[model samples]
Target chain A: MARFKNKNKKAPVRPVKNQPSVDHITGQKIPKSFVFSRGKLPGPLRDLELDLRKLMLPHTALKLKEKKRNKLKDFLNVAGPMGVTHFLMISNPKSIPHLRVARTPQGPTITFEIHEYALAADIARSQARPSCPKELFSNSPLIVLSGFGSGGQHLKLTTIMFQNIFPAIDINTVKLSSCRRIVLLNYNNETKLIDFRHYFIRLQPIGVSQRIRKFVQKHEVPDLRNLQDVSDFVTKVNRASTKSAVRLQEIGPRMTLRLVKIEEGLCSGAVIFSEFGKEADDAHEEEDHED
Target chain B: MAAELQTLEAAAAPASRKRKPKHKKSKNPSKRAKQKASPMAAAKPRQPSKKMKKLFRKRAREYHSDEEDDGDVEREEEPSSGDEEDFDVRDDGSGGSEGDDEEDGRGAQHGITRFVGGCRAFRVAFMKIMKKHLPDDPLGPILSAHKKLVAEKLAEDDAEHKKKGETKKEKQLAAENGHIKPANFLDAKEKFLIGVATKGVVKLFNAVSKAQNAQIGLNPSKSKDTKGVESKIVTCFFSFIHFVVLAKRRKQAFFSELQKKNTQVSNSRNDEKGNVTGWAPLCDSYMLTSSKLKDWDKMAEPAAVVGQEHESSESSDE
Candidate 1:
């Protein structure tokens, strides 16, 4: 009887708790995103996609599988269950890179032609001392959009789309500690290009002597052979009152994007605006003629 | 047989002579004129008049008899072949230069050159390919299926919510009292624009709050600052009053006592600096003699820590 009881024994099951998708304080659906490429991307663009996924962070699927045969509807179908709010799809057709940012289910999709891009590795290689801690991507980046206020309805829609793409921070509830990264989108009205830059926010403590700070932070003892007394090290140079110095260090996959088209649906719809105005209209007319 | 042959030859001779003059006349004109005449000659047999048909039949009979007269046939074929060769060479040379000129002109007009075929041919080819690949709309079925699934899911969720009376009540309460206003009334574009504006406002508010916090510290109330200032003033006034009350005698005694203590401390510090038996030299000797500090140069190597760990363990064993 004891042998039979031992054979039939099973491990106790643990209760699973579901994480809330809605913010309790604001009662708003927390925006999560999926960054994927529709078509096959080249090595550099694939790395850029990975960097973008990192930029989205915590809320985004870091390792989302995308197949060449998968269409927009496949992603849309999956998005409903996963609670994915936005889709960032990159495609390189005719050797021209295009990024489509769309809202899930229904969308006013914005298509941008990537004129130029530099991978994060390139940015890091350029710096003397590059610092990208693993914890840096634990929190999503704060977005600072500039020069998007004055524009047409398409521009306004673009501004809104960019704003909502990232999780909105409630000022009262946001922690200073978690604000570690910033994504700056600077729109050039003259050139009609948007400069996208990602940076790490660093705060240096002021009012401490360099030698003392180095010793405390790194635990490396300074050379005492040159000094007559330890007091000389501390009192040699006295700076002003202590305050935190805020600085932004570039940690990038920089992109120069030109808005090409705005569509009404998710990757398909009525063209609300287009960069190639007359040519696009002519092409549309030709298509209509053919139809 | 010789007499019959002579009769056939005599008949073919006049036809060949007459055709030779006509061919020579055509060749004497420009290449464009020859090209035009050749196509017209080829088309003539398709819809020939009665007189033209009779002439063609006579030419055909002459052609059959001329086959036996190889010399006449060769003579007739040579000129036509030579004309064709000349026409081909000219066409190629002229076409090459014309294509170059057209390319240059179009290249200047448009920054990009279309390496594909002419516009009409390209359009026709593209249409043919599209028709072959896409007989019907491929996306329609996929979109409709997705829509159906989404509708079913929504209906199921509504049914489930109705079954859960508490959840339904909570949802109703949330809809009524939630801070986030429903954006269903606005179109996609308007919603986007409003979202942008709201985000901008929130960013501005957050920036202002951060700046305010940095400037005046974390306290939000103005009354607290005023209260702090009043307390500081009261303390200063009381201190001043106390100082006035004990002014003359206490001030003199405090000054003398402070001067005595300063002199004593200076004397001790001077004595300590001058003394050879002090702890400073001992500390310097200890730091200099320490094996860890002695091997500092060697310790700076990449694998120095591993070496140190090995040495330390060996030393411990010894």
Candidate 2:
């Protein structure tokens, strides 16, 4: 009876250890001392009170609610001229990676970022072009001539024609760049310096895309302009920048793109005209519907 | 044949057929005939005086001149002038005077031959030869067809030389005189030009903290009213919805919006987004940016749906 009474009073259920809410994918806990229990938090995690201590320049940030009129895309575009690489939007443990390098020879160079959410985003964005006014117009060093014709048969025809030009170009001769070492933590952190011509063909101002667009309508990936276009572009670096064939990064809130660094490229004005032709046709159709 | 005979009659026989010049012999031909007979070896073999010897030599020379020139002329005129009175006759018709006319004719012929071979008449002679060989062949109408072409080629050469001779100083002077300005390269034309001329200042602090938090007003997109210089044609090239995600992070920091707000940190560390969120007056007023973030802010001029881009921007002709 005394033993039973002692069992009932057993020390008020103390947990053997803390199950610390670790990063979702990385089976490890964020160090216990990671959270700085100081000053004032932004009410709660949902309030997103930023740890200004971690920020490179706390004074440079703008508040979201106060600047609701500002589009995230335009903001990052402005940041672009600043050479931003990693625009860490949120630390949602759920965010998955688009492409995950499991392990380098030394083991996974970037592992934790490969979560379900990031993977989905990466997949979705991979299938799409990322820049506006289209990235092709910015005098890119690497140009990719993917026959993005309307249908399968159209694509096949384009590919065959492209193949003829491709061989003469010696695309294999294009030098692929290895690394984009971002020495400066700020600009390099957000911007990716790439060997744009390494993978893409530096085309004449007149190219297959222009020719295709000349005859038929080709749509641009929607809503493409960003702040990166207007700002004062400064080359913040020490050594010569390594040119990567493709660069993947987030510009604004959730905008992502697979940017092929075209050295000299421009989208087809003819394509734009064709697109207008289609638009006019669509408008007529809409008018008929209205009637 | 009859019509052609009539045409020939009407064509009027060549002037050459009407005025052939006649040849006549003088003392030289007579002397030459006598000399051929060995008459110059004086029949009387006397011991001649000095004066007599000189007179004999003169007579011998005269006799030789007539013999040589007259015989040559007669031989040339024999076959071609078989008909009577067709050739040009000296009024005297005497061997001596006619011989003088014959000498004049030979001198005229020599002058013409020499002149024809010079630069001015070389082409004329060549053309004459071509006409004789192919009288009616239009393709070989070298004399008639080549003149215009030759003149044009000469003119072009002259113009080219003149251009080559022009000095660099003249070109510079023309430029300074504003003969031509360089082509305008502005994409948006006038609007872009205006953008370069305009400027603006952006403040970061929420008015209360910095300068009494005066809310910077925005002009309506469709308003025709003049905007402040600060808000002009500003082109924003935002690649992604960067500020939105930052906002989201900021939101995450705010404990009030979460179910677990109680457990959230109390750090109200406001990382200023600098003046990034302020309104920029674009010179074009057409500068646009787009984003796919649905719940976040939309670019005013050219925002689009998740899957669809704005039609105008979709036509990115620029």
Candidate 3:
């Protein structure tokens, strides 16, 4: 009777041991604990946050909802970039879910969690290198994430990471990187010096994607000027991004979702608005029927 | 007795008529002899010059063997492979003049010969002999007919040259300018010459014998496109497709002729084709590469050979 009672009782939540640490929701591995805790924001980070707030404060009044504004502020505090006007945060954990932000001081910035995905596991899975060494760590060198907007914007974010030296080392004794020796910390803290100065920090220009997205969004009924732009719209559909757009439609309360059904390579189904809730469901049912 | 005397007189009458003509010819026999002698004197044969005699002797010695080889039962079965190459050289008579003309201008006159053993005339003669001896050979007869036409054309050209009294200098000049027509001259009117232009300068070549005279035809012109500035030059080579088309047509004609003849002839022809097709492309590519070499810069100074000592020293340093 005691065993049955104990079985009915739920187990207490505890962190798993020895496994590489990663965020459950974002799948992004938490980096070395350098970001100061809430009540203990250090001088440099405080100064950086203050500078960002000062830089962003004069641009425009914060017109976002109170909840969204608080979230954005918290994110900005962590990632100290200036002039962040809008952002789309991905919540799923299949790949590293990230915030696709525009109107940043450094142009477009994709802030995401750094995951401890392995390059060796990827190479092994691909069977690319026949004689791959057993000692090779399973941490990936590249982290690619993407999301879409109903505003016809395709955001592709690619970040490269490795077991390299953390650049923001806050120590006078470890000023000269070559002079210092690497002391391995347990299982997960092994690192070597890699210069990620030029490539990693800089943003690769989105060019056509950003421009076309802005153009289409600005003119809701897109009257594309050229054949190239028209072709781009027709052919270039980011499948990964469609989920975010669908999510966006589901979330926005006031905005009307104009769902167009595509069937048999033609728009044969009805044009349903979000106001008529059953019609949207009907259109989806028709799509499922076609499938 | 009167009837028999009339019959005898009738027979004697025709005999008497024949005797009367002989009596008349005997009176003017010297006049008839003088008439025949005078005609003979009018067409006096000129004695051949020492050089001409020597050339004839040399030709007899060299080309005579080729003629004898045609009749030779053993040689007829398996022809000398080298002679077919010579036949190709000789068929294009312009090839001879081209070498001479080039040698005159360039002065590197080492390997220039006007006559090879298996010329068109010689081949025709050889074919004639082969046809007479080897009657069963269907190819021999047909090829001989074509060669005979070629020989006739050559003979006509020789006659025309004699009539015009074209001097050696004029002939040489004509050859140098590529004005001389090929030996297998189709018509008196049509002349086909290929011109290769590089950077603004043009070099001409006889279409037929250009491959055979690669040394002359391939060498880049000494004349400059401009006086000072070096121009970016482009050169176009003669398309081997024309030769391929011609060969296809010839093959079709030969096959058609073989169909008319026995299957044995067709089998032998196919065997001959198999032998030729294997090496023909290799020979053509060699000819093309050799002819396409227009780097005349090497003529000024012989390219210095890097010696073993220098190579060893360079390798040791490395």
Candidates in order have lDDT scores of 0.60, 0.27, 0.29
Q: Every model's DockQ, to 2 decimals? A: 0.02, 0.01, 0.01
Candidate 3 Cα misplacement greater than 4 A, ranges:
A1-71, A81-90, A93-120, A128-291, B1-318
Top model by TM-score, which number?
1
Clashes of each: 0, 100, 7
List the candidates' TM-scores in order: 0.45, 0.14, 0.12
TM-score of candidate 3 chain B vs. the reference: 0.12
In model 2, which runs have C-alpha deviations exceeding 4 angstroms? A1-291, B1-130, B133-186, B200-318
A1-291, model 1: which lDDT tens digit per residue?
A: 344456567655667345356878767787888999866666667888898898888778888988878877888899898899999887765446667899987897888888777777777776667889989898878787878878888889999999898778776556666778788777878999887777777644456567655654454546667889856765677463324445566675778789988889887678888888777755633432221
Docking quality of model 3: it rates as: incorrect
Candidate 2 lDDT over B1-318, as tens digits, reads: 234334333222221222233221224566433423432141122233566446544543453465656535544543233121211232233343222222323322322111111212333443455467556643344444456786677779888888866755554443223111212232352232222211100011111112211222343232211121112211111322455578888886573346224423211211111123422222133123311112234343333322224444555533
Candidate 1 lDDT, tens digit per residue, B1-318?
334434444433423433443444444447434444453243221233466446645654554564545534433443233333333344534433222323322321222222222322333543454466443642232223366777678778888877898877765543222112222233563334334433543454447456645666765544332334335434554664575568876986687557647544233322243254542323546445543332533533434334445555665566
Model 1 residue pairs with clashes: none
Worst 10 residues of 2 chain B by lDDT: B199-208
Model 3 Cα lDDT, one tens digit per residue, B1-318: 334334434323322432444335435556534423442242222334566446544543453365654424323322233433443344445333222222211211111122222233444564565566555643344443366777677779888887677676554443223111122322331111001011001111122123323434553332121111112110101122355578899998797566536433223323344356652223446435543232445531222222234544655566
By TM-score, the better pick of 2 and 3 is 2
Alpha-carbon lDDT of model 2: 0.27
Which candidate, 1 or 2, would have the higher TM-score against the true structure?
1
Task: Return model 3's CA RMSD, one decimal.
Answer: 46.6
Measured by C-alpha RMSD in angstroms, how accurate is candidate 1?
A: 27.3
